[model samples]
Target chain A: MRLTTARRSTLFAGLAIASVAVLTACGTASGGGDSGEEATELGDYEGSVSILAWPGYVEDGSNDPSVDWVSAFEEETGCMVESKTYGTSDEAFSLMKTGDYDVVAASGDASLRLVAAGEVAPVNTDLLKNYDGIFDFLKMQSWNSVDGVSYGIPHGYGANLLMYNTDVFPDGLTSWSAVFDDAAANSGKVTAYDSPIYIADAAVYLMATQPELGIENPYALDETQLAAAVELLKAQRQHIGEYWSDYLKEIQAFETGDSVVGTTWQVIQNSITTGNTEVVLPDEGTTGWSDTWMISSQAKSPNCAYAWLDYIASPEANAQATAYFGEAPSSQAACEFRDDCEAYHAGDADYASQIWYWSTPIADCLDGRTDVECTDYAAWTTAWQEIKG
Target chain B: MSSAATPHVTAGVPQPRDTPARRISVFLSQHARVRLGLLLTAPLFWLGLVYVVALAALLITAFWTVDSFTGQVRTEFTLDNIITVVTGSLYQTVTLRTVGVALLVTVIDIAIALPVAFFMAKVAGPRLQRILVIAVLMPLWASYLVKAYAWRSVLAEGGVVDWMTAPFGGSSPGYGLPAVVITLSYLWLPYVILPIYAGLERVPDSLLEASSDLGAKTWRTMGSVVMPMLWPSIIAASIFSFSLSLGDYITVNIVGGANQLLGNLVYTNVGAANNLPLASAIALIPVAIMIVYLTAARRSGALENL
Candidate 1:
């Protein structure tokens, strides 16, 4: 059947419209652009906020009688916090997809994935009164922001410190060489973190000691850099007594004198029962995690989510939460409420700037060097298996 | 038979109407095939829909890949995951180490269980047998994690074993492969012993008497008569210990020092890394091994005896 020019044009218009609709549908699945939902407007609380957090982030004195910030938040805002603690960031990332949680205490490795998947939204700093009090060093970073839009309120931060027994290292150790190069002095007594993310620690050590390696970002390593890191780990493996993923295991090992020195978190040193151990930010800059309180994009209690975020970020609450977790509180005023702020350098932007925050490596270079492809998290996982082998 | 030929039950009762339930029962009773179909419907549905189908779906997923960056499952089929699992040296080493531990644990349990099971079945009086069986089963009442943690403390430096052996100038082996094997053997010993005890109880005293009447010694009778009869139960017990130890990631993590097993690899890929395809591939290793083991067991007529 023959058609007129006008009819043919009408058919082409329909075809073009369908193609654009299909392309946009594809775009929304993964590369969600600008998640069109508006941030919640301030209003009366929604009565509840279901939270997914790391342990001690949303305490109500159940874990320890003194650690109780949720009760105060509940009393003041009337937004009761029903929280579930996850062991790893991966578990938190998976849980966030259910959209059941109102807010998540997400680490840097998981925050970006939540953003990329549109499982979380760009948090409105204006809604959170305490957002301004957050240290400037923790704001608008790579993992917690996308295209300069903040995704969450900074909660707290901590470095992976070089912790050593006081008696074993009476001379006082400085630098990661205590765990890598000089670790042989206490062979069969050294420990390290167990996760594949520990690969970044090796890279951080290399950045200080091996200038010839030309490694810029601890997370953004190419094949050769990853191999070098793996080689160093293999050498370190000889001296390793154990590799600990949980703070409890590390504490037990230290108390029993099975582990004399290793990579550790500040919280682990506090948990040690018998040993007089001290943690330090060694001469080599370290890799660490900065957690943010992110609201779910599909939050059922948006108002309460905002209220809880603001309340948790307040000076007193942030201090209690961070001190309990043994980290530097994000709020500048939290230092006054907590005594160990000097040890953590709570408001010291210089020390915070020195840390290479834990970000999941992607093929696109996180350091913005695009000439060669960077090794991603999958590669790190593979290299880690080999290192352990 | 026709309704006209149906027999009446009682004279005083009113003529019973052919209710649907009555009709179904009547029909099922007449046709053997229908009766079997009706009887098997619930169990067959459960095993087919829940058990077999789920396993088949998981097996199908072994060939798929994941977008490692986004952590989304990609339905598109690929063999790269399977190839990597087969070729990777880490997978090879961990598989070997896991099998070695499982074998050692099985052998140790059998060696220990054989005599204990004999005592429980043949030597112990009825009262002592009951107490011995209760002793073996009591550990299982406690949580698996609690027992594993107990072993952790027992093996820790300056702990129970170290203190007990101080007089002999020996100490605990600390935590590693040896500790893993010892702990697994201790945990699965009861599983091994129960089956052997049951098998031993089935052995008639009259048969042993006949063997002895033919001038056969006790050792010869045990080897020739008791062992052959007990073979199937021993195989069943081994399958229990082997599979349980093969998939144990938690116990190893608790006591294993700087060492990993096949279970740890599968677990990390599935949970921590969010790479399900790789995890599925790694999971298939033990599944294939188990299939082969079951087949071998079947060839030895274990299926009938078990």
Candidate 2:
């Protein structure tokens, strides 16, 4: 019962990787294909176009009946759209890998993996009328591009910030150390992102604490550097009350006083923090990811896919998606459209100077890694289990 | 072998010396021509092909290695995955906890179910028994997620438990572990009650009368006579509860909160980590443990009468 937490975490990390392999096989075997061929022949995009998306990226008929974004796209293009919401980047990639949909709105965590695997094709930027309106920074994002070849259209973007209960940390909370290193004092009060991708948070912290490990960027950690970060995480897990992936669950955890501080995205922070809770951008920079809409390589209706992307990328459409999801829109024109867009806009020229945009931890790019090639996701996933344990 | 031993019957009459064609006709006559026979054969073949073969394939894939960059399974053999699982303390903890919880649920369910099933079978009239059975079965008809959500509301602040305890000067926050247990018990009560009730129904009135006539007290008659006869149904019900709790994800996910379970861990590995090998390895451990416990329980004379 009193075993060193480091040893226990290593053991769990190994188990976590083993579990992932089995689940992937089962998911791929069933429903294996892009939109079927016959669906393409339906005249002038009159038929249903299935798009794979992450939850909350697209509104359904359930959340607010009048807020269905797909209905407007349907009316504009004469194409009825059906979206199957995925809970994780892994699932979305797994689905797209099978070539089953006309489009997949992938997140930064997954879009690179998809492009490297050739599951999604390079979008013809010229064909997309709204492409010109997309911010230059977003068009050249690391995850959605390969050697300057753009693979996806920017859809939604948000930074991962620290959220804390003001009642618990009234002195204007600002550091991750107060959450991770001092977790023992905050036991049964802290929560972290529940996904494997959260291993990046540990990496981000280690670059400062264990500089000898040479972890330049959180995502670009190697095996040895990752092990050091994992050690830090094992110590932190004891303080955690919950590891939440669902936005609704995170909001509930904060509302119920089960969680005091942890990693959070803008959407959950916006929803959870009322008068009692507060969102903080720590002095040490945080991590963020941008979500994108990409045309599938196996698209049955390429023309319709282009049309769908064009309509959704418009200033009016991006404006609506940004307002609904509470994430920053990638289109510059979207911010000019409304006051709500101004609130989400993050630039040197704007007010959100504290927010750090997502950058892949490769050899080049702003805030990129200079150490051993970033920890391949394979190891991070394994380490994540141990961290949770 | 049974067919070879029997002489052919022609129109309810036995044929002492049968021709080859006549024997073939007789063999196919009654058992082979009916819709029921086709239905029975069809299901067996389907189960053998799909369930049995699919499970074997799943086990095979559990041993395969994964390609890191593409996230595809590589065509290579390795024991690293299995060893990783066996050595992992987190997996071991989750596995052990799942089994312990399942056993506790089984014991508690059986204790509660015995009396209810007894009353329905021995004390209640037919009409009353029917109504009671329906009342027990009603929850099963509802969607599982809906039921879990209902339980969450009842356990949360301003929930029914809080409302009931308000006058006692305690806040309406949940007693978390207690709420989870009560919810699981309520959800699986029908699974426990149904089998025991069915088993008790088979206990003949004559057997009870024979015991009573032997100068036995009501309690003694129940203990020595009626109880032994109901062992099979009780064992069957216990098995149902044990398995339901073993692989359950939704109940634990919705109710367990910060407390981790095997099902929740497995769900996370599969859904969040996207590590299929790990998920499969974790999934297999619970199933194997379940089989071992069930086998051991079966050997302890738990199902002798049934």
Which predicted model would earn the best TM-score?
Answer: 1
Model 1: per-residue lDDT, tens digit, A238-263?
88888898888889888887788999
> What overall lDDT goes with each candidate model?
0.86, 0.72
**Candidate 1, position A79, lDDT:** 88
Could you give candidate 1's per-residue lDDT for residues B1-306 as a string of tens digits?
344455563454586798999998888889998788888999988986587655655666677677777677666668998999899888999999999999899989999999999989999999999999999999999999999889988988888999999999998888788989988998999999999999999999888999999999989999999999999889989998999899998889888888888899988888788887788899999898889888998998987887
Model-by-model DockQ, in order: 0.22, 0.22
Q: What is the TM-score of chain A alone in each candidate?
A: 0.88, 0.82
For model 1, what fraction of the real interface contacts is kept?
0.47
Q: For candidate 2, give fnat to 2 decimals.
A: 0.34
- Residue pairs that clash (backbone atoms under 3 angstroms), model 1: none
Candidate 1 ranges beyond 4 A from true positions: A1-40, B1-9, B14-38
Query: What is the CAPRI rating of model 2's predicted complex?
Result: incorrect
Model 1: CAPRI class: incorrect
